[model samples]
Target chain A: MTIAVPTWRNQVSPVLDEAENFTVVEFKGGKQVKSVLINLAGKSQMERIRQLEAIGADVILCGAVSNYYYNLVSARNIKLIPWLRGNVSTVLDAFLSNGLEHKRFIMPGCRRRRRMCRRFGQINKRKE
Target chain B: MAKKRQSTELSDKPRLTNEEVSAILNSIADGVFTVDKDWRITSFNKAAEKITGVPENEAVGEYCCDVFRASICETECALHSTMETGKPVINKAIYIVNSDGEKVPISISTALLKDKDGNIIGGVETFRDLSMVEQLRKELHGKFVFEDIVSKNERMNRIFEILPLIAESDSPVLIEGESGTGKELIATAIHNLSQRRDGTFLRVNCGALPDNLLESELFGYKAGAFTDARKDKPGRFELAGKGTILLDEIGDISPALQVKLLRVLQDGTFEPLGGIKTLKSEARIIASTNRRLSEMVNEGKFRQDLYYRINVVKLEVPPLRERREDIPLLVEHFIGKFNRLKGKDISGIAADVARILINYDYPGNIRELENIIEHAFVLLSGGVISKEYLPDDILHRKSEVTTGAFSNVDDFQKRMILDALRRNNWNRTATAKDLGMHKTTLYRKIRNLGIELPARDGR
Candidate 1:
């Protein structure tokens, strides 16, 4: 699966740079997955999402996402991993080791009821 | 038989046509809804459908509460009360939850719908969407007040009041103050509150650019004006048309450019570089200076004409020492601001620290005070700010009492004598007696010290 990361100024992709701690990694079938990375250097979030979707990214990793934007991206079948705060390499290592399995990524302003709904859907239906 | 037939026909006649009533109700942009005496929904129009998101088909046969779920009832509902009293209710703003569970603001009016017999049958309410008014009210509340400025001094307050008034007029304004006195803040407040508020507010730091670059930035540049001028670009003046442009650090501009600026101010026109067409200038100009421009004019460093043109209205901001009373207040304000920014919960400064702050003459003024507060907050421990947190300059300044800078031995002696006398309640005879000197000489010394003697013996 191809993963996309949005950065404002700093380069945080750990496969390209080893020293940075807050990096993003992709995996498929329990093996390290080589992915296509898209740089949204100076564009706004909406514009970045449009660019990423145009390049056919399956998952997006970013520091934070707004509620409206989360809904828009989720509606487009793109998986969103948010609140990934750390150095590039450490975050990438954690993702590669399956340590990010229990991390909860909630959009800003998403109601508690909606989170509960998502939790129930994941538990009973195995809906990813 | 004919009379019976005519009576039956009249009895079977239809009421007002549905098409006519629907057209009338639908033509009104305001939401129109009617409820019977028992508060059952009798009619709902297309506008009501659009406003409440409940179609007429769903609303016609249900009670108002069942259809709209409004918390409004006979005693609480303004519409119901007006209908019961046969009076009309004027515009009233009310918040209601729409079908999508979004709170919508609405201005509504209600009246009693009566029959030909003058008896109240039902109530009709007409309401308009109030989202625009709500948005404008929010915008108005979001306006930058004088408190938005960080300074607590009287000089800044005076500027805040004068800036809005100056913004109303079309004349040029010159703001003179020390560096970092928030000259830019004053200019922005003027533009944001002015009649040209909707227009752009452009700034060009006169000291930041060279003469050629500054000229090109102020006056537009046409294609082929210079090596980098591959395309035409409108300068700040034209872009700030019908708006305001702040010429920051205007004192540093060269004399030649000063002449050009003076011509633009006088004629309200300037030509772009490498272009023959002279564009009509309509921007209001506000210039700031930290240097003494009038002195520069005297020394031939600045043009007299340009100085006078920009100085149409001069505002001089006093330095912070002149407003010492505002220092403690400013310190607290800055502490609060930085505490939130730095995520430190420093409650306040200690009394001794406050005293030192009050006594010190801040040469850098408000900006200096802000820096000191920020520094103190950074080093503060256990949420208490003490003198130890202060910079070395503040703590190391020599005390006046310990400096010993008096003119002569006599001056020191007089000061000591007067201090002793005042401490002893000005009893000169007793003071002389204490110091083993004659009362007359002590009196002479007191007189020489300029000490006022109280009237005695009614002489």
Candidate 2:
């Protein structure tokens, strides 16, 4: 059962009309597609993470991940798919075609330090 | 016992020191009057004469109620209550019908004057006029609600009317305008007015965050989904259930997010970070962009599909220069608002300052106008705001060089008049005929333009 994590960065998630944030799209095979939309009432990043966990989200696909939150979510056994860029549709197509291997997840604190996580198979090429 | 009775007899008749009593009563500035237990006025000082416009000869020994035009002393008087309760009354406001028949506001403070044995003998009451304080309160209340969101232009009025209507709808709305046009304010107004008025109105700057971080922020991740995934998280879509969300600077968002957004539009469903269960939400979307999305699409920078989805309803806010008529109204609103906030008594804007404001093009729109007004209020010396308070940028713009040729409508009209006069060799009749106007009207226009005709020999 391959589940899809809908995100604002990549097109794996369903884009809600009037939805301010990204939501998770569950697809069982190609036919069963159920969407769960989430909006963080507050702008705080910590509150957003907590709300997602409460809703039983398994994976997060995003364009960028802060190290502090990345570590916090990773410690809970949730898969973090980061560094997914492009339009919503293009990202969704990429997710549907290549699955998890094609997606890029950045390590927490990599933004400031420019360090790449070993799990994603990329080394820190950019100087901090 | 006979020696003690002789000492008491000497002390019973204490010496009346007139100078000391007069000095004590005259030293204080508030109206002071002493009334005995029988309510008969015993003493009235200089301050009392100024407050009541009555002299001591007319007030002394008079019944306090009869002198003050009251039916009785203890019925409704604050001073009587203080005397009876033996407690000092402090700053009680009362309306008095003075000798001129005009109602004057006064604050009265009273205390029961006691003798050496601590027995209540009489009451002393002090009252001061509260007309100034009442004026200040009126000014403060005027400053609160009348000042913000200034603009009297028809366009702004129209916007005020439409704002409530837009808020009533649940459809996705796209606000397009130049920077500093209060697009975010319009979005907020819509959220505040809509059925989800009480719900959270989340705003995300699409241009500020990159793709991956933005995605995760929008859609939560599962715990241990990756090495750093600490716990499962819910995204903004789920968090905004039955609430309104604002996608600010939507033009800067990536195309990938656009596709995911399209799916949500197709079906209100999305999956969590690593969870198998699909979540459903009914979050309303509102998007805003200062950049021209259509132009961006043409340049291949933005997605057409996403543009269509967000552009379900579009509202364009015009710049300040385009609505010059609203400048006066906005100026008044800002002045009133800032006056109360800054505790200034600024009455209004100077005519010359208003003229300068109307002429200048506000690149920052309403927000910029508000800032300028606030600055002006702070710098205003007296009740009047002058042009000197305005910033240098507001005074000067890059001067446009005109080659003495016709550029605008006024210039074109001037050029046409000059050409006709020259062609007709300064002949008024011929010039008017050539320009297709009445000779008298042409003469008036020539006078208005201050056109000089060359000297000609009398024929």
Candidate 3:
């Protein structure tokens, strides 16, 4: 599975729409296979969506995505795990371990801590 | 005796009672709340309860993040920052989803709560709902819009004013215009403003299809109505149930089709090609033709009865040449549109390019101008659309070389005045001052040049 994360200073970007670069990580059998950084700053929203689509990203993990960006990203059939804030590898490890539902990774200010668990359940349901 | 004396001394030092503090918080207009170091709500004021739609009693024990649902909660929590840094954040714009799950715009401020010993204990955040302000801004933005059409032209503005009134009634409307004058757009606008807006809006070009095909396309055909007519097919009129159907190029239909259409307009009833039962049409008919139906009627090319039947309410869309003042507005609109579509940030047309556009009498009207801008967008690399990016015909074609004089002094003068007026944003005084002319002279020149001023009727 190819997972895309908009990154800033080696962490999930504070705001998904303003992200300049994305880390596209390909995982197979719960292990990282390939990781590449893709620059998407100064491009339109549609262009950013296209870049993610080009990489065949199955999921996107990011922070503070607006409704407009959410609709655009979701329309491309990619599962967007928004409101995530943490170091890139740490978050990725948590995701791989299915610990993404824990409160430690909840983006600050989000009211529902368990929403991440629901989002993970949805992603798994889609996979099945 | 020592404990009593100590309590008396502490009381004498000055402290607000809980009631006084609550009164102060409730009196202020802004929503205020305090949270402990662990992010649990410690105090929820009356205003906070009102803004968040959660009562103070209910909100006090809950987590502050859960109550606010603020966008900054996940990224830039001012309260969290204040708690960590022991500093205050003032009046930052943020958004929150209320208990009802509606996004609400708000501005917030945060400060750390400290004891007399200067040790941080908790954080307090104050917020104000911006619903009224945001609503005003939305209404202001809507002031420039009419249906899907945007224009500053007086005639178009007049049409915009009366469109809702026209849409309220169920009557046949005849729209006359040169090709590319947006006849179909007006028809659609009418349909959208009417009560039938939620229903389907269909269009059929009478000129594009032959008489037999047009007949079946408008009235439908039954199964085995003719060879290859195996299944019953519904036409544009049938599909437009309780909605609107735009019959474009109505003048070009054959006489046989015209009579049938006249019956539909007059009686709102028609039968399928081979069906025995007659069906009532709940659709409103809007007929449009670039050719003058009045002239066609006089020339015996079009039926007089049909022309009068469809001409119950007529709208003549002014060609772009007649409404040259809208060119810049239309250009800006198209530039913004194409920027989103093509992912390019072309600012606008260059001065020389604007001059050329204003000078060229657009024979093909607004549609042609849109195509020109689209062409420039394709060729332009960045910044703006200069003369170099324009089509070769627009750049090199001269008046005397192909059609007329390349540099007509009068046309240039008119275009310059129009450009100046637009640059000054139709401020007559500023435009006159910038032009180094008297206001009277400017007004006279505007009159002579036929530049339509912005509508004063609250557009």
Candidate 4:
């Protein structure tokens, strides 16, 4: 599985829309593999998504994302694990160890609601 | 113990206890929080808990960004700057997402905390919940918002009224307007309102590329079609499956490309380059252009049949000058947008600047107004955008503002057309021919520019 984490210093970027760089990790057979960073600075929301599509990230571990981006990411069939924060290595380790669901990595207040774990800080997109 | 405390105090006012300080912090309306040098929350007041929907215990030890989630927390943190520079930030506008995932607009001020010995400690940030104020603004903005587009213009509202009706159908939509009049926005609105909302919305600028490139972009190219084509590449129509494809600047497409587009609209089938088999596209087509397609057709510069094909449902988005009342609202919208983008706390434009904006003729439409505000933001450090912060052309406008109307032409094309009209002895048809434009187009330009034509044709 391939995972893309929008990075800010060592922590996950707080805002997905404004994220400029991503640390893409390639995982295979549940073991450590390859890791690389890609910069998407000055790219629009759609352009960023297009870059992700080209890269083929199986899952995206990210912080807060707006409804505009969340719906688009959901439509693209990419498993989005939003509201995750903390040191990149620690979060990656937690995800690898299957401890990602623990509240330690979840963003503040996301643990309050079950659905918020899926999409926190996003307005529910109107389906009409 | 109270009598003993009174005896200990030498000053006129008695010293308040820690509990009293806590009580004072809890009593006020604005939320207050102090963060240590490590960026961890050291103290979160009761008001902070109430505003954020996070309890004091939950937020006190957490990182400020995680607890606060302000729009600028990660990037342009006010507290971070205050801690670094020792300069306080006052009344910076921002929004934070609360525990319920609702965005709460707030104004925050940050200051450096100090110890009794003057030792540097942490940073204190006080935030005022602006929901009530935002609600007042929303009351003015809400009724006019249609989908993502905001407008109160009667004609635009009429378009907003019939958009759902238009979106429900599978007919090709033609959105005609001046550049920056938001033609593409209208297209997106139509697509989003349609049943194809879930499907990918692809936009291809028909005018931006060569005919061959545009053709390949619109129709999938088969392997071996070109030397670089190692494998078949699906085009926008193929990728837009069950979705909507917006062909922007359709008026600028070549005649040959226009035939292919017409074929797609008519038969919903097209063969890719170097492919014998035909493919069907179920994608809905919405075309937008700054040029007048009707005039293009009359001038024989555009395909008449293609014009009829895409003009099934026409929407003409008026320019900014036509919808002058929307300037203030759009100004507010752009101000809020730029504040978030630039991480500054500009309140709004000055009253005189607002007057200048309202009365000015925006030839470049809404986009020009937005750029003007964005340019002003680049110069302003904080506070409201005033006249001095505006662009030079806007500040030093030619001609006197005697009646709040410009006597001189603002658009360069207006001056060129006037010179052409004079050179052609004021014969409009001859002038249009000389300018390589249709007479009606020239006539419309004259009317739009407020050019007072002489009664005598001078033919």
Candidate 5:
């Protein structure tokens, strides 16, 4: 399963629409296998989603996102886990260990501002 | 002893406390926010919370971009600019994505917050929502706006009125205009308003490429068709797929290619390069040219049949000088565009700059004015653009056109009248229309200017 996260300096990028770097990690047999950083620079709102779609990203972990981008990503059928924060390693470990339900992982200041996004780490496991 | 007493007297004055400052901030209508050097929000006022839909308590201590969600937050944040340049950005129009995920158009101004010791502690930004203003402007100027093309000129408005009818029809459209008079915009508008808007719209510049290259570009080649043909490729005709294709500068194509194009227009079918099977095209055709196709046909340089085929519907765009009224509107439009593009807070042109821009005949039309504004943006970091920021040619042209070139007003008028007469082949009515004057007024001007007539008269 390939999971993508828009990343900054050790943390999730502030907003997905304007985020520059996306880390696509491929997990194999409940362990890590491959990780690649893709640049999402200078892409339009629709083109950004198309880029993720082209990369075969199954689940997208990101921070706050505009409705325009949220709708487009949803239309593309990519599992979007938005409003996430913390150090990349911590978030990844929590995601791997299913520890994201812990309150510390929810993006600060946005606890009361959740949209139609799903609860953290409730992503359905896809068949390999 | 007297100096010490004066210092004591100064210190005794009443001072506003932190609560007073917060109260003052909250009382204002515009959204105001402050961020520390670490890019974390230090304060978010009541208006800021209202505009962003994020509570002040929820916004503070968070990274500003996460709360502000400005379109330029990641690329060229105004607060970042203020912190670096030591210059405030005043009234820069931008949009912020609110908590509800809605993009709210807002104009922001940023300044560096400094302590009493003159050390920069943080940056402050104030913004006002422009959605209502934008909506009102749109409603008030709906007639002058057609798609992205903004013009208050009468001729352009006439074209805008007929564009709906043109879009409804499936016939080939021919748009004739000066190079920068927005022929491509008119074509795109028709395509967007047409039934094929969901399909892709592609354009090919016939004058940009050589004949052989253009032929292959329009009609793709099969594998082994030529030296570079390694695989069968789909050309614009096939890729357009019932959409629309704009053939810009169609007058530039060679007569050989014209026949192939004529066949496509006649029966909507053509064979690809070195391909035996005939392929059909359902793409609607919209052709545009800077040159007159009829004149080219008269000279046998362009095909008569092809000209008639593509000229089923025609649009003629006036030059900048002919549509002189659009200059100020276009200047504002271009300034707003460049503010977002170049990430500057340029408000508008200075009064003298606007005067010069309005009077100068843009030989290159709207595109020239756009380039001029872009050039000004490079020289102007913020605030209104002045005369010095304009290009040298435009500066010189303004003086030459207005004063220096002609000995007197009569000489300039004579020169202009003579040129207009020659342009219309001495036809009084067409010359009058071209000059935006009455026919008799032009005739009287011709008589008073002592302009001589040639033997082969247009009359």
Candidate 6:
């Protein structure tokens, strides 16, 4: 399977709206076999969609995406794993092992707010 | 502060036992758990229980994926992968459905747990709750309003600030905007704010009527003034006595009528058709046009002196594409408006619907946006407005969205300016520095581009 990750430096770009480069990693037997850098800067959204389709990526992993890009990407049969934040190498490794969930990858403030009262054995009143 | 106190209390306690380790794990704020090679949960922490909405007793001994219900469990197991690759994964972000079936976003980290013998045992995972971030993002969408007008765009906000003041004035206010840019709305606002608001507020579409009819309409016709003049009739000006008269499509008026209108604006006096006696108009004049009157003046289609006479105060409503920030607010406004008018209860618009709306250049401006919402209302039975209900032309307006630039010149320019402003943290100085231009030049570009400077809050 081939995974395309839009990158800034070595990590996934924070926002896909301005992402200009993508690192396509080809995996075989749950391991990275090959990787290539594709720069798609200065391209229209339609052209970018076509380029991604031509790349034949099975999935795209990136950070936050606008609604337009999300709809377009989903319209094509590409699986999108968005709102990810991590080094490209680590993220790819995690993907290969089915371990893409981790603390360092969470975007700020997306954590669930749970009632701590029950756990602490208090009155169980939820935090306001 | 509470967390600090808890940490201090924890430091006072002794450690180095299996039970102590388990207790410490449970006390940690982030959810932590250990999975055996078979993916069975060997240990579950208090934070894990709280985050997953399941008790430790229930979570223990169960398959990690079964307990957490993470989307990756059925497809890609992080612990399973961590076991295969000795390298631990750090800070992988994902979402999982909890006991209540709510999708909770989380960030997780995994590492191989080793015994005292230095042999790999089970894999450990830690995840932090990220609901606050998502909530904050949602909270930031709506909050722009000016009378009935809704917009976050700085230009619109500026116009909003001056709208009341403009309305209070008795001058011949010239409102220039593209079609559907709310020229008539602004004219109404001025009239509503003016002292003459209680009197008859009359509107005449100068372009909708020919020169002869427009002349008779503006200046009352006497009996036998024309073939249709059967009796003495009061024109829009006389009808709008002591009130406000909005001359819509003013640029479409003929030169002869322009001279007559210019005289009225110049001295508030005009002669009724077929009447030798001159009449005085107590009405306030407000002119609106989608055409560039200055260009018309240069083109010789419109009288230059008349343009100068009527353009006492000009309000230029920025096109929708130049003020994309206003799109969300406008969408919300339109949705509410249509909901009341159509008696339909659409909760809101889907993200995709908003995306398509914002991406559109809006050649027809706010009126087009209202029409789009009304169109959605016609098809929307209940629930939210989705892309399925959008007009076919808008849904199929194909353009690459990746660049965030539209084919419309105004849209592309505004996007560029906004992109740069955002990149520079909205600091015009830094933005100018990064753009390799002087600050004043940047300011001019911002003004020319119709980019509004945000309020004091810098939202």
Q: Estimate each model's TM-score.
A: 0.45, 0.44, 0.51, 0.49, 0.49, 0.47
Q: Report the error of model 5 at residue B88, Å.
A: 38
Show the lowest summed lDDT stretch of 10 residues, model 4 chain B. B138-147
> Where in model 4 is the C-alpha error above 4 Å?
A1-128, B1-145, B398-459
Candidate 4 is graded, for docking, as incorrect
lDDT of 2 by residue, B1-459 (tens): 999999799789777698888888878887788998876788888877655545677667755543443211223576678877888988877644333222345788888988878888899888776545654663443211111234435565556545556777878899988877767777877776688866766788888999877777776778976678897878888888888778888887778877777767657777666777877768889998889989998999988877787788888877776765455556655564565456677666654464456556677877788888888776764466667777777777413322222234454456556644643335576566555578899879878877777564000
Per-candidate Cα lDDT values, in order, are 0.63, 0.60, 0.73, 0.76, 0.77, 0.70
Candidate topping lDDT = 5
Q: Fraction of the real A/B interface contacts present in each candidate? A: 0.00, 0.00, 0.00, 0.14, 0.15, 0.00
The residue-by-residue lDDT of candidate 3 on B120-211, one tens digit each, is 88989999987667545533432111333645466876666566677889999999999999888888878877888888778899999988
**Order of models, best TM-score first:** 3, 5, 4, 6, 1, 2
What TM-score, to 2 decimals, does candidate 5 have? Answer: 0.49
Candidate 1 docks at the CAPRI level of: incorrect
Question: For candidate 6, lDDT tens digit of each residue in B340-433?
Answer: 4556777667645655777887888899998998898888766777677889888776353333435465664565456446433365764555
User: Which residue pairs come into collision in candidate 4?
Assistant: none
Query: How accurate locally is residue A98 in candidate 6, as Cα lDDT from 0 to 100?
Result: 51
Per-residue lDDT tens digits for candidate 4, residues B328-389, read 55786677667766678776666457557766777788989989999988998677777888
Residue pairs with colliding backbones in model 3 are A108-B73, A108-B74, A109-B73, B399-B404, B400-B404
Global CA lDDT of candidate 5, please? 0.77
Q: List the per-model TM-score of the A chain.
A: 0.52, 0.57, 0.84, 0.85, 0.82, 0.81
Q: What lDDT would candidate 1 get against the real structure?
A: 0.63
| Number of the predicted model whose TM-score against the real structure is largest | 3
Candidate 3 ranges beyond 4 A from true positions: A1-128, B1-147, B396-459
Candidate 5 is graded, for docking, as incorrect
Model 2 share of native interface contacts: 0.00
